[model samples]
Target: MSVTSRTRFVNPRLGTYFGIFVSSLLGLLMLLLIFEELGTAEPLLRWAMLLGPIILYAAIGLSAPTREPIEFFAAGRRVPAGYTGLGIGVAAMGATGIVAITGVFFLIGYDALCLMIGGLAGFVIMTVMLAPFFRKFGSFTVPSYLGRRFESRPVRLLAAGLMAVPALLMLAAELRVGAAAGGWLTGEGQGVVILLMVATFVVTAVLGGMRSLTWAGSAEAIAAVLALLVPVTIVAVMVTNFPLPQLTNGPLLRALMHSEAAQGLPIIDAPALQFALPGEGMAHIAKRFTAPFGAIGPMAFVVTILTVLTGVAASPWLIPRVTMTPGVYETRKSLGWATVYFGLIMLTCAAVAVYMRDFVMDIVKAGVPSSLPEWMQRLVDLGFVAIDSAAPLNYLSFAFDRDSVLLSLPVAAGLPAVFLYFAAAGIVAAALVGVSATASAIGNVIAEDVVNGFSWEPLPRDGRLHVARIAMAGIAVAGGAVALVAPTDPLRLLLWSLALAGSTFFPVLVLSIWWKRMNDFGAIAGMASGFAVAVLTILAGEANILGIDGALASILGLPAGTLGAVLASIATPQPSRSVLELVREIRIPGGEVIYDREMRLLRLKSRERSS
Candidate 1:
């Protein structure tokens, strides 16, 4: 596909332009509000930060006249391989993983880093092994693929519910982060920030639908990369001045030197690096060089594999990318680009954490005000400060305090214009990308999965579009409500979402794709079992259930559910031959027909065969 073809098709309507213009103006106004409230040195810097992404989104909305709004949701089978790949990479490496994961690395040390590397490796494996198959299958949504594969509406509905739950949770977390950032910038309550953020998603989705989201998402992804990179580069330059090499030479040697200097009483022959400062500790050094495992552990490893596989195998978002592109080869090429970009973006997140650790620490030392919002003060008190450590960093701890840390860092840095600009942009990009993707996810489920499940009839294209917009608004409103009542600990909510996905959907998705023996009975049982285990584990406060942490629990939980389902299926009668055939067809390569077309064809052929 040509580059121009991949770009958004414009809507000539003045109202659309007006909507875009209004949104941009509101964003500018919000930025100014935040700057004034925060008493930051670079208040005007907020305008560029807010205006850039808003303008970009508006431009996308303006393109709606030429392009169908559904394209924003699914890219209408027209996206080029390169753009699709980039979009996928950006979409996956969203605020949840990039910002949240970095905070985890900073807190835990090298162990967390190791875990992250393990997770990435799992993604790589999925890319080579599972992504190809998913690309070949060419279904828009996972549930659509499931419905086709099983020839059971119940299965599709069930899968949709599963997918929707996690997606919503993720959306909420994204909003929480965005609102917190806005509050910090504006010194307004988090409530106001949340309302604005949620409103953005509603208006954009309502106006341009998927077409707008896709173009906006792509543009936001680019902005995100720059936003994350600028501040990281700045901090990296600053940290290079520290005596890093000397700190990591040898713990024993350092201890002896310290003892000789008689600065303080040495506690241990070689103190664990976790006890020292960012640049001075062995733990900090380990974190920079190693990967650590905290909550994700082996379970995380399995979940990561599952997430990537399912993402490729059955995700609606990816399906549209395949169809939108002109051809299969182009789609594959796009996937390749996406993989590289995803890896690069994830790595950049780690680098940013390393550079920002000291900056965070400085903020904590500055002391939080009692009058500040509870979330902000908690972040400071909880030591949201990242410490340079040799051990894999614990991102979870920092994640727990992310809202506060992100808000105060600029101020701690004396509100440098450049840093604030980058931070603000990153916050907005992360929120917009996250909310938009979520809105798309919810819309896909409702339009293609839930609506079709009731009867094998596809909703009219326009009706489907209408339902999607409604779903988007509903989701945003729900997320805003959750943010209103959510815990101050941002990381806790994030971990809960990850853990839920890892334990429930992660296991079921992996087994369903890889194991042919996984019947519907097995799938149902497995999903239920995995979800139960995850919820129970969280309630019980057990970090490692059955000696599995991180992504491993999901891997383990899959077996538990799969075994139950397998046993049940074995005891029951087998599904009909038609059902089996449907499964095979759904899994086959180049099954490019839309849900409605495919269903009609299947019924017609079935009647003919019977006759």
Candidate 2:
């Protein structure tokens, strides 16, 4: 085969491999379900659930190592659109969707739809505005693209530094979720489980970089989707005698609304734009379930969606995956696949929330918190749920950990603990997939963009791959340290990541493609100012200096970043003719990737120097 043909060859059996991989997982679960019915021991089931997927994914990573930089960095630009979309969708959902957001839905009811709306909309924006252009340029990392577009190493390095902040923050967030799931499975301390989780993430990415992550992530996405839907569907059948939870949950929602009234839950008297206090004590009454802006203010909700929307549009991890496809057309198709998968999983998330609420109401209506169901009481004893033995158990009488509610659903409905383990295993898969993708992006920026940009002599291909793997390990350790020492709420960490990313990259990424006037000065200024403002606002909000929190903190940062860029670009001289030509070239499609042409020139020069 010609060199180009060799580079573009993907294994035809890849689909068969992943199909069997997913089927095997399902089979294992079914066998475990049978064991549970036969009264198998709980610890044995936990070990199987915790270790099985890890062993399988690790084996894939171990076998996927590649010395070729093309394979390591961009999967040789040959992944099918279906797999590419599945990878992106998996990273987008991660544990935040499977664990935290499911709990968000259960806790906040209709208000949680903001997350779903922002995320799905972000995919749309990315599809239309960014992905195709980036794929045309074909740089493996976002910093590489920005640096080359502006023809400035300083711009590239600065983007690399700014990108790492959100990347590591997201890394820590996923690790936190994984640790929580591990703790539940093994009955071990989060510290020990987090260490294991960190090792797993590093191993998955370190072997083959993007090559390993893409395929392993595809498998992980399958496991996560199946894990989420199967149990929820079973619960749907149990509750409504219907197999489709997404469509059949309407009656359950109505019943939940009635339950809110029966429990004397009051509608909020505050304006939709005003923040409300979370009530104190276990038996405190919450706002009515269907009330808009009950969990957060209107301003906060709108800002959160905008930030998350832009963040998803400009997500560094997601952008690189688009470039792994065959071309601009396949890239667009992959995102369409992402939309389908993301929408399905999100609907399942809504179903999980409704089903979980229905279960909680069952306990509340029973009016005896002390006499909780065995499963619910287990969760309570584990500190995942808290209930007060008051005379009349209402919504106020019980409190739930947002991270625990989805996992607790099987047991809440008196199902076997095996189902709980399946849910936890799926959460682990989702978290690992996210961490692997983010870690790969961060390592690529540091190794290929930042470190390599500073080098007087470029490393050979093998040397570059080694450096990237080392960088991946270093980032994993740093992220693991944060996850271990100061693991905060996963949802809060995710918000910081989204806010920082949207503020720092969103405006610059859009302008770089659409506006020819965007120069290196603007890119540098925009990224720096946005990064600073986001960090300050989040810190101030946490310190109570301002009301800004979650995604709301980015409201000022984004506009400030945009204005800073525009003004800086205007004050500086317009970009040179060559730079303007480059921009025009990037805007057009169906040509050689600019990065590939540049690399070929570099290789030719290296050979001339050697001779």
Candidate 3:
């Protein structure tokens, strides 16, 4: 073979090989550490494991030049579709999702399945209604698309600010989970571990930027899937040997049912296993499976779905993958593979939840510590101790409540090295994805809204890249700070993010894209109203917002914002002729060609015309 052929065959990119090698070594080291510290590794091992991916990503970022920061931030618009799809999946599977499902399972027995079905339904809605639209618009940020469609600079700025708040909150919650995990693994002060984790994430994210983040995220997704599979598969086999129905019909189930039935309810109905029912069985499931919806749930779920939809629709993180390929068909093909990969991971998470719920009571009976802290002891009284016995690893359960225990599973599994590797990967992915969105939004704000409106000196690519880097660094710091200050409840933080997104951006984005009559006045009114309602709901302790709970809040919040926008649109005068014309341009398919051409012409105009 020729030299070029051999180089291609060998996969000459040193970074790719180096990443794999380092990850393997780190995994091995963590395994060794786990064995050494067995029963007592809690937080120490967790913190140490976080180092590997950080170093790996930082090395990648520092080795590359800073001039093409957009490429670094957005993968040079050249990411493979498979990677982008996987990246999206991984980002979605943050610490909160893992912890929440596990906690829910421990509390509700098998009835939590309904909630999972609900979530899957939401995802289906996203894929069918929202994904194609996003794929078509092809913008770098959600706000940018809004700016173009509505011809309103203020609206775009408001969207950016709204998106940033929730993103930061979610990021903070994830970091807190990691920190708590570290505390469990090491048996140390949570504050110290949290601080270290925060610092590490901020430093690594600031240094590595987006290019490094993409590669790291892909690897993390693979590793997490594998780790989750091992335990879930083991539990699946175990469950097959002791099926849920059989167990429920045995002595333990009968005893509980008999005792509780005297209170006017039966505890062991066949259908109750599949869905929620009334009486003692129902009460038990309700206590464990349901959350307080109030106003928070509806607001949160709606906002989350909208935020994710917007992010996926306009994020530069995915844009690079589409641009890397030569055709849309290839992009779609990659997306299909990505979806499959993501689905499998999500399935593993659900299975793990089921397994944990099946055995949680037994674990708690066996693992509850007499010497636990007062708060932890109360948790035990409240049935939180069950989680310790549910899973093979029970350290977090023995030490904390169900909520905290769930957050600490990555550490509890005696797989700190594995978790650390996963965390490092997750952090990089989140930072890169978040920063890319932020940078693109900022770029659009400046290039199209700010600079264009004022006719000031347009920023060059190099300058734009510089600004993006600075913005990214700031974002990392902000995210870290929020992580430090926020409540340790991952679910709560997630709800907050989702509610904010739904109330502020979801309604406006959907309307702007599909409704031609959606003038700037209507868009602004809708967003502002949504924001106010969500904030008030959260403040009033109605975190779940609706009867469907936190998981469904995002979907429910859509109408509140949409209504506000529609009513305002009708109340306000129609948009100016120029604004209506702008919407027409945006509605056109392959609108990106116009944007690309405009950018090129602007660049050319700035340079000398001489041949």
Candidate 4:
């Protein structure tokens, strides 16, 4: 009956209590937002709801046991499987990814599933090829491991440079998504919102680094999952009297199919499509909603999947989830758990996509202008939905921005006022997770690879941590600045990140791990030659390279990179004996450190002196 005993009895699990408290807080906020619907600045309410989840996540991140380099960079390498899985899942799906991927189904058809499957394939690649090796090799950052293993400083610097492209681009894209959500909810300018969001992200990210992300990621997973589920659940219940869209979407799908038959809607060549062209009285192709390869052909379909898997496998941010685990075995086990979490998001994305398509067309089929929601009007104002003189909504189609599909869903479905606000808030939080993680990765590479590499004066522990913090801040600020000046397409930016990762890093990483004879020249040749080809291919395709289009754009990079690597390795001299010996030890799994030449020599001297 002592105070300590009483305290333990009263709070059996702080986590459960914390969950109950957060849920109650969110409920109260939702009710308050609902009550304030009687004429006021909605952004003020939006800012509150959005900041609620974010602030909590930031607090959680800051609470990590991070004081040393190991804790700061790898979260003491003790992250649990559950949270790691959730963090990886949320980071992979990304905020822009959610909107963009779901839009793919509506804009195209079953073809969208390829990206989802391909993304999942990346995890499979990691499990079989990369994750175990990284966990076994044991390093804080990708570049660090590569530089040490290859005994090449240039390799580390160049690796950091290659990853920076997608990491920085993705960070800018996520901020832009956040700005859009903020602007929509708060009625603030996107530019102004970008500044605020950058501050918010830095506050959340600067705390505890990798350690903070471990816990914050779980909370973020919940917010993002809810954001997707709430609308789909509501819409499913409304249309089919079922809460789970995946199980009960048959009727909803049928309704969409029936609606598609009746309309002369414009056909969208989905893969490269910008806006659904409002054609001048052309016969609409009665394309099936479940049609195969909607805009892209067979070759492109194959290429898209390969590219996504490669991209997913290659993403620098994602690999660390494995590196942060306690052991190599745990890293493998965690990937399985991570795959399950990823599968959940993939399922939700697929389900929500069909529902969005169904919801839009059903509204069209009813031919009821009065039933048209205010969000539809918003879409029209934003030019996503076009109007005609005779019809209520002349047509609704994408105009470059695919995010409009998700943005307009709440309004198009006419959910409760508060539900709409919550939906947007969830998306904003999801995007925040992606950008924060990207910023951290970009910062880590700069600090760990480029800055930390300068051994002119080895930094103290405090100096190293300080450099890391400054790098995080600098990357976040730079990404925000980029967002303001030249905001790129969310989906395209994401693809570029994935494509660059896959083509440039994927081949080199795979060869480096499994092939022992792979020398520095071979590694350099593979990454550089392959990266140049991949980037050029992407640019050429984007520029309609020789007027060729479709899946033809994808097959060149990985193969060329692989071939370049293999051939160069054959032509180059074998690595030094010390390098080969190190490679053998890297394949093992354990918590013990394997000493290098310097450490071994010092140990030998100490033993001799003792004797």
Candidate 5:
């Protein structure tokens, strides 16, 4: 546990670095705001906000090159719990989680809480059931762990293949988000900006791998959180004379309820928590801020939350983060920190939704059609919101695209242009962290578990590093193409990705760690069946061809995977004695990683053979 000369802990000046970064960022933003006040050309300011932070991120990436495998693959396993936790939180939220969730809350009111609740539950499961054990096992990737556990290269390769889709989907979603933010800021097309974003992801990921991502991601976390909080706080202070948006939103909720009632939107005596589809009977009329389940049904709510929980718990990218920490104890503490930061993020999101709803309701009550707010016009020009008609504007007349609403919120709040620019930078930061993290995971998995697993001989150190960098760039390119071609919103793409993750990895991961009876046959059968079911059901759900929907895909996918794994294990021979012993060792705490030791021995044997 003690720090030694050989240990590669993060620089102790990390705090100092972060402190300086934040100050410079905010100072630059304020300068831009003053320029606006002094009547500088608007186009120049827009371009600066769009490109400034990206430049900073690239600079960080350029500084992160490393020749060592451990440094590139695992950040040298010396990241403190707090920093690791921040990285986890940022990676989990990405641009989709932070932006889409808030926008969904704005659109659906209380029903959006399900996503937050499910994610928090997933973190708890990770802390209690998964992360500590993974840290003890010390694999570079999830597929690496599975390969080692089953002692089968085929199992490892299959896992790498199965996991690639979810990772790519997530990468696509993040790229789309960053592209949208950049498009909005620069008045450019998404296709063009997405290409730019892809290059940025590749540069950052290929240079330092996890070592760069871990540290830069921590910095992005700080910027994203501050960007989310500052505008919301300013808006809160203006309306309620309170700076704490998380706590002072009660009055706004009451105001929203009154506005809905006065607009004759309909009111019902049904319990606020009752489940009802959008515009359904009693619950349908329950559009008040405290009301729940109005936007989605009971089944949909349950499925959505469960899908998110399982997806997050077994996220391919997030799980490997446990290995970046110092030990099992630090892994546990890191997850705990992730929970705290994630909760703060979701709470702040809710506050954004409430304040946003309050603003729209006031406009509706004003009953001004021709004099619609300049902010709404800005949104319309930007294509984020559209007015339904030339008649008096009501809440229903304004349609907000959920994927882009977080970027629009500053406009909706009548904040100065600089605030809008600052929000854009924050979204860019969120999307970058997500892009780098997912690309890193996919690249490492492809190189280590798939390519290396297929090799007749282990690759040399330098060869491995080169392959990894090339793999990362290639993955980034594929992800960018998907982002450009897919018509789905970032949220929908994100949900599908989560459903796939939950279906394929969640069951096998849990069983492999906790069930000694699990073998290669079970692992293969479970992954194949679960993945097949998830894809078919997700497509069917998207097409409405069957009773299934995307939200419920995992409801069937997870059970299918679990059943396949359990049944296949029962029908097959038991695992060998060595594999069983490895399982037992992973369960215990405070020991060297068995996988690391085996890898070293295997390398020594290879060297002897070559000589």
Candidate 6:
């Protein structure tokens, strides 16, 4: 690629434009928030803040050129490494993970850190074990790769089937998250908020498919980073007299632990002291709070980390990102960016979790809701912040919603109201980016692996675009409807989704790349066993028949997949020489399919060479 071509195709200027645009828009939104604080917020402006960014991102998505199949499916395989990494990092984090992990960290304690650790490890696994080889094979998604590698329709079908549950559930959950975040700004119900978010997905997916989503996701990552970092930095300066929370949190933590109520409340002896928290890790609390793996035992911790690693590798939409990069070197480099981006966010979440835990608790100890400001009252009305004047433990038992932490952080901490606006915007962007990626992945999988596989009848280029858009729209609406009652906890849903992905896809992809002898029968057996065990275990546990918990559910499936594939491969017929030869070319890079009509000629040459 020449310098001009690289600039045109791979090196987009959107990153700089995104920063300028979001900063200005955020300033306007913050002005609205400040006016609202003074009781002068215009309904039109509030609606704009809630819906405007979504519309703008949708427009950006539409602007991408997508008249071609490659544009629609793979973003023309020209996305620069930096953008791809940013997209992956942002997409991997859902609204639930954003809110819940931080909330859990502060609200519960150290267990949240385990997820933070595991999350970073996941990118490393993807980079080293999976990233380079897949791009060389040149497929858009993991399921597509499975179909070709195994040379079996059923194998692809199985992979697609496993994909549906997580993709749909995650999209639905994110829609709810977007709705809830919008509710913070608009004071609307989850259902009403979802309508706007769902519409955004529809318009964008229909406009340019993956080409648009790639840029949009990169923008969202930028928005999320700014929103998170600014607040945490401000809070750190205010509390600890420093700006960097990650480094300056130790003194703040001690202050939070030592800070006490001006007046005491009568206490009842509950399982854990409900009245005046003596700081979970403070001297008086049960077993010092320095525990690395909260609630989950060490075994569960191992399982959780391994599952995250496997799940990251199995990620369908994320894998497509690698395929779109300019080359193996770029793909590898993108993973580094992904790791750095992911770490920055994860670290911010941990700092915010610790900071917010103290922030919320201190507020509670200081006679919440009643003594709180107007912003707290608004939050109370929205149900994220509530105070029971009649509670037994003074304000100690006051309800503080964990999932609302990210959205409510600015307001709860008494920072400038604009932080709230930017935080809400970031929340919407993160949720939408994640949902659109999954929706796009599902649509592409159906279009290529299932619909196109039915007949050698190559799907017309336009037909692929049409079906993919319809598939995405259907998923968005269906997911929105499901979001009405979807679990309030996005992390719980995320955990199961990752488990399912790790169990079914990761083992197969690994074996296919490393062990060339693995045949279709082995791949099918591996996937089925893993999928069956993981799904059944989760189902049984959910229905209350089995004593199984979700913490390590993926652990039960990983071995099943590996063993099934290995044992079944030994029992089944070996893969033919032609398939092995193609695998060899795939293992090495640089096979040019010279012409559309000459693919068969290349296959014949491979067979002849094998013979």
Give the winner by TM-score: 2
Give me the displacement of residue 326 in model 6, in angstroms: 1.0
Q: What do the candidate models score in CA lDDT, each in turn?
A: 0.55, 0.82, 0.49, 0.70, 0.82, 0.71
**Alpha carbon lDDT at 259, candidate 4:** 68
Per residue, candidate 5 scores C-alpha lDDT tens digits across 265-312 of: 643343332333232011112355666556566667788788989999
Global CA lDDT of candidate 1, please? 0.55
TM-score of 3: 0.70
Residues 241-349 of candidate 1 have per-residue lDDT tens digits of: 4333213223323333333233221222212211121221122222222323332344443454553343333333333454445445566677777777767766655
Q: Cα lDDT of model 3 overall?
A: 0.49
After best superposition, candidate 6 residue 395: deviation in angstroms? 9.0
lDDT digits (tens) for residues 508-532 of candidate 6: 8888888988999999999899888
In model 2, the runs with Cα more than 4 Å from the true position are 1-8, 269-285, 368-372, 455-458
Deviation of model 4 at 446, angstroms: 1.3
Task: Show model 6 residue runs off by greater than 4 Å.
Answer: 1-8, 30-39, 256-289, 360-382, 387-396, 455-457, 485-488, 589-611
Q: Candidate 5 regions off by >4 Å? A: 1-8, 266-286, 388-393, 455-458
Model 1: lDDT of residue 184? 60
lDDT tens per residue, model 2, 1-611: 64454225667888789878987898889899898889899989998988888888877777788888888999889898999998888788578766877777777677777788888999999999999999999998998889888988898889888999888888888888888888878989888887787787677777788888787778777888888888899999898899999899999888889988888877764444443323211223356667888777787778778888988889998899998898888889999999888888888888888888888788778887566778777877767778777767778777877777778778777777788899888888888888888888898887888779864245798889889999988888888888887646677778789889999999899999899998899999999998899889888877877766645667888998899899899989899898899888888877898788888888998999999
Off by over 4 Å in 3: 1-48, 60-66, 109-128, 131-137, 187-208, 235-342, 360-400, 404-458, 543-557, 570-594, 608-611
Candidate 5: residue 285 lDDT (0-100) = 22
Residue-level lDDT tens digits of model 4 in 87-170: 777787588777677666656667677778887888888888898888777666677777777788888888888788878768
Give the higher-TM-score candidate: 2 or 4.
Answer: 2
As for candidate 2, its clashing pairs are: 283-396
- Looking at candidate 6, the ten consecutive residues that score lowest on lDDT are 273-282
In terms of lDDT, model 6 sits at 0.71
Total colliding residue pairs, candidate 1: 72
Instruction: Report the error of model 4 at residue 28, Å.
Output: 4.4
